[model samples]
Target chain A: MKTAVSAPPARRPGGPAGRRRPGGGLSGRLGPLGVAAVAVAALLVLAALLAPVLAPYEPDIGSIVQRYLPPGPEHLLGTDQSGRDLLSRLLYGARTSLLGAAAVVVIAGVGGTLLALVATWFGGRVDAFIGRVLDLLFAFPNLLLAIIVVAVFGTGMAQATVALAMAYVPYTARVLRSVALRERRLPYVQAAELQGLSGVTVSGRHLLPNIAPQILTGAAINFGYAMIDLAALSFLGLGVQPPTADWGLMVSQGQDSLLQGYPQQSLLAGTCIVVAVAAFSVIGERLGGRAAGGRA
Target chain B: MNDDVKGTDGGVIGRAGGGSRRTAGAGGSGGSGAKGPGGAGGSGGNVIEISGLCKRFVTGRGSGRRTVDALDDVSLTVADGSCLAVVGESGSGKSTLARILVGLEAADAGEVVLAGRPVARRPRRAERRARARDIQMVFQDPNGSLNRRRTAGSAISEVLAAHHRVTGAEARRRVEELLEQVGLRPAHARSLPGELSGGQRQRVAIARALAAEPRVLVLDEAVAALDVSVQAQVLNLLSEIRRDRRLTYLFITHDLSVVRQVSEEVVVMRQGRIVERGSTTQVLDDPQHPYTRLLRDSAPRPGWRPVRAIGRDAAEVEA
Candidate 1:
């Protein structure tokens, strides 16, 4: 193209540098609910990471002599059926559920986003094919699909993580496909196309960046559901195998004790699962509000 | 900057593509246009020549399918370094003409010979890429054309990086020059599209088009969204850019007031057909066609008042 060879600026605008301003920080950008939810999530992550160090006593070492002692100062928060510290086991259990949720979010979020981008970009036979496949996946309930995946792959931490993530792909892709399709119609993308930029370049540099907030919000919401779903899976013996100190595993181990005049272990672990899921869902909604251009 | 700005001083048009980058500039600016029609015709030949271009759009589905002719065998040409303004009301096919010229929408029938190359309906990647640089476009809504993801500097520099053989530092330097050329200060380059005012955003859009060093610029109602004062400023900048760059222009606008200011030749269209074409002074001063007269009379001017249809009045209809 002979066009750009000599199209140089004949004149220059004289101006001083240092006029650029910084973007607003989180407090300025996010609403109060978002800030609070983020703070709670951060705290939960930190507590889970330091579970072994923060826990007051060894979680697995059992004492049959003082088994089933009620909430006493010497064994604060009481003891499990094996007379191990219930508080310590609950704290350690946080690690498995939280990390499992994070892994599912990452796998599902990335895979779904890519698929949505392709579907929006191609928009004909390829789009129809993806739609049909997603519809087929959607036919099964989330847990049933996950169970099938886990069954086929064989149960374990890695298998369950992948299974849950695969089960979630259809849902994530559906949500993002609408957003991506809307963005695909934007003039800037058309401008990029006219410029002869490749599909990958347009998506990476233009389309994806603009819709990233929606992706982030979707991923955040998925994290909470994923946490609850994984815990349920563990409760059914399809995830977080025994001796892993998972909250779902603890609840399952303590169910028999609930009718034996002690329900502390199950109650505490269930409370932890509820708190984490609620915190994540709140954060996701707040971010979603921002993405939707809703008022603060 | 030195690599990009060496003055031609009586050479072939001063850009690389004045010699391949037409479609690339056009592609980015033209909003998915495939390529410009042809080569950078020798400075002696007409820069753009169209013959019987036609486009039909199908509406509805199945039993309700209906085809509407968006463009009806339009033909025109412009000498190198000249401006041609195509004016019409909404649905008159003026925009469709502009779109086809830049290769954004494929024509159902007819030929577009740019710099004199016959643009294929679907060209190879390299051919389309070349056409992008040859013909760039400036859209009606400045805010819609720019990538909100990028700062103004990055937006302009991206075009240079993609088509030009310049280094990073050179590209940055050229971006500063382009910003300055469009009347944007270097300080404004880091601002995102959302942060900039409408006028400032237009300046960015113009800078992006200029980055490709285009031989032809298709401005599609580019100033339609701006306030009066800003529209004047932008119009001046466009004319100045054309003069300095020796670029050809295809100015598409419904506003006849601007046609006289920016173009040398004028083509008037009604219902997807060209009703009249001539020099700006000739067509505008003594319009031969009824459509051209309607356009001239309706255009706003000092002391002008709206004229209702005399024969279509209620009293006349009742009688």
Candidate 2:
């Protein structure tokens, strides 16, 4: 099988684009908005963790005499209808809200990604079966699914969070499955298979790492959605329960005060929810854009 | 399937048994030199034998679905330590044949015998790994063959770790040796596929394939993606490796020039069927089949002009 030898140079010295760094540095990739979103997210997490030390008054212990007090030296951001310090309740509420959303994201993201990897690795009927099941789950609205779980299991943060996660699985799974399917077809996966690596090894190492950016982006976006969904369930009196400092319950509790020309409690709680959700969304979008760019 | 053709060339078996590596001078005219058409037939110990192979792909859905035969009853054999080039246009079943042989795709109907053992269509994990130990494939696109996220050393080491019991320092040493054998520096092993040139990546892929130490190497358009100069270099490297390892090769390609350069026997395929098969010299010099003649004439050469005759002849071949 010999031919005329025309041995070229061993190394060609990679082009400028090739030599320039793997990730292009984190700060450079994240623009101003992404930075702000990350900052907001970090601050919210810190505030949640330090709620016990940060709050001047206990979130559940409020006086009826000091009810509906306006924002002043005594109570920043005013007092709720129960005369609870809104600042203290908001801080403690961040703990329940963020942790609950995190639980939903972790469960849904991990479960969905594993399902996607399995479907993609063992394609054909297996993929079709998993896809159909996910489609069935996809048909239900998230809140309705949460409501059914709450109705069946009785209202609590754990029940509501689990139900919301089930509802979210289809979203993450569908997106990840499509991407994983594309990654599965690449020659790298075939090379690994031809090397005698087991299907599990190929999927875990070659398949999963290639689609990790998509997983991160999906998880980030789902975190925001999970937060909003859980808060909505709490607002409807199906999650976190009364007297447990939660953003959604705070919104619902301030409703009566809203009608009496004192909208501080409801508006402030709603703004916190909006800010947190928006921050997560911005970060997710940036990561998504970067993932796309990396592919291109 | 073609039992009459078996054991026709005793010389090939003798050379294979000798297990002598090719020197630089001998390699220039090694396999294809001084051999007649009869010498192209397989020896008694065939490394790869496929018979009545068929693969059909159903694309689209419902009313739009159409079944395309990727391989239609293709049967061939490769003598141990010989390279058999399967040449055709795209969608002519050459690649499908390679894929099926390497156990990437299951044939709708047929049998594949590698190293005298029948391959299972629906192979279990152990069966699949056993088959991989006998045959490995090098894909067309070098960039796509290795994981972009992994370093070249890791890719090679993974294959070694999977097939052999080597680990840590032992594995790393073997990986470096494989790199040097492919004419790459040790430092190149640390670089990602993205950082390597097209030719460098192809060499890494070839190195990884060698890590399996298989009896057969199926190169599916392996060097087609490289530049002309780089393609020649890789082809030489492959020849040297095959000589050293006594590896049988199923060289699937559309390039007639490449077929002439690397293969002793050539099989002409068109639309999922083998049209002609013979020693490379006889087929290329004096083609018997009209499709073979068309393929020969269509290849670009010095002062060769594109003509209207090709299009009309292609239609006739289709008929």
Candidate 3:
């Protein structure tokens, strides 16, 4: 038999990335669902930012006469149990909800990115160790671990936000790690090595940028999850203190009014949470799909 | 699946480069020669010497299927500033040999002496990288070789920064010069690999390789993927670059037709072994080995057909 030289050591089936390209851009297969999700999410963010200006009344102060008022011309979205303006509170709650989620995403993203880079750099035993740690993190329910962190750190916006961020770190690290791992062995990296470039330089210069979109997509998805988790934390009174105009806090406060048939506050905040989370989730999927399409 | 071929070569080269190092038989081409400065200057003598080089790869992973003898007791020399083509069928181990030469793979046994210094079976990391500065590679796929995220000019500038420590505008200026040398316009530097055509991308790869300004280049089927016309153009560019830089080349390919265009000597490998070695003209015109004869016969020519072997098949009774 002819001595078969090692055929191309490459030639992994489905090529290196092994991705199924999303049909088209965010607007393609996602169609109207994606567009609506984006539009609603953008409006929520805008309202959240312009809360002081957009809202007709202050989110914190409430009037006895205005309390329990149904949706009316003077008080939009009606009044919460405290008689605070519902529109103002929901707008303000957007700040609390989205900002907290954004914080979690940023913290998780940076931590995960650093860990992924380190794991890929060390590889072998170090890589395995990191993989195991991430697995342990994944083993616990994100909310459960986050609650535990809040329990230890004591309940508050900062603590809950950080707790949730920590809970999501393993996920971001695992995802970014895999993408970075694939790129670490690519020929361009090897080409850089042939120039005698340092591992850190190669990672920072080449591997990181190629995988940036993947990280962004991951963070986007994490943002949605973080938002939901923070809301639950706040609903359980472990997040924003009462009278903070937080959506989760509003939900917890509005429960009693639901029994009395004045469900405007709880219903509005619940709708806001759902719309915001869904929008972020869809956006995350779209970003991830685009990155995968370009990658393959 | 659609982009598989476009991307995997670099991934493979990555694993091959950083894979475990293995000890092999002593194969250094040692004849006392001054070790001119490691990076640039040289005696313009034998830039590469391989002796008793053997590489065996175990495939099928844990199933213990078979061990592929990629290179077996291979010995060859590439004169300083000369081009030597290692020609064979796809499985003949020519690519493996190229990989070993460029420090992309470990040889189970053998010695490779580059520029009068014997390369260790496994050198220290710094030394390995230093060796990279001395010897570089131009891969088979130009698209696979370059970083898609980086502009063509920045890619070259990076090699300049990494090896020569040329920074800022100096590196930018040098990148343009290298681009021009590879027959690419200065504007081509601003474009990414995806925006460039295959031929232009190949030129970018060459420019990037030359950025290191190494003494030796291991081109593993560098021009095989190009069009016939582009192949001729790249071949000429390679020769011109060699003339200007005094670079030695280990030009590897399965195509015999282009061997004469790029190489002075040819080594024909069959089944992990060197079956024939001599001048390109001598080996192509007057072959000795039966396999060589078969290969010569097989070259596609108009009106050529497969000739029956003597006393073979159903005619065996005639013997």
Return the top candidate by DockQ. Answer: 2
What is residue B148's positional error in candidate 3, in angstroms?
Answer: 2.0
lDDT by residue for model 1 over B88-205, one digit each (tens)? 8888888888777766677888877776677876555566678778788888887788876677788888888778899766786788899999998776766677667788888889
* Interface RMSD, per-candidate values to 1 decimal: 7.1, 7.8, 13.5
- lDDT per residue for candidate 3 within A174-248, as digits (tens), equals 989998898877777778865656678888998898879889889888888888889999999998898788888
Q: Per-residue alpha-carbon lDDT of model 2 for A1-296, expressed as tens digits?
A: 23313121233346222475455667666789999999999999999999999998899989999999999998987788889999999999999999999999999999999899989988999999999999888788889988998899999999999989989999999999999998888887998886657778999889889889888888888899999899999999899998999998888888999999889888988898999999998899898898888662
Lowest lDDT block of 10, candidate 1 chain A = A9-18
lDDT of 3 at B209: 84
Residue B175's lDDT within candidate 1 is 86
- What C-alpha lDDT values do all the predictions have? 0.76, 0.82, 0.77
lDDT for each residue of candidate 1 in A232-256, tens digit (9 for 90 to 100)? 8999999989777888888888899
Compute the TM-score of each model's chain A versus the native chain A and list the values.
0.88, 0.92, 0.88
Give candidate 1 regions above 4 Å deviation. A1-23, A64-66, A294-296, B1-44, B63-66, B285-289, B293-319
Between candidates 2 and 3, the TM-score winner:
2
Docking quality (DockQ) of candidate 2:
0.40
Q: CAPRI band of model 2? A: acceptable
Residues B98-137, model 2: lDDT tens digits: 9888888899998787766888987777888888887899
Clash count, predicted structure 3: 7
- Quote the positional error of residue B26 for candidate 1 in Å: 25
Worst 10 residues of 1 chain B by lDDT: B23-32
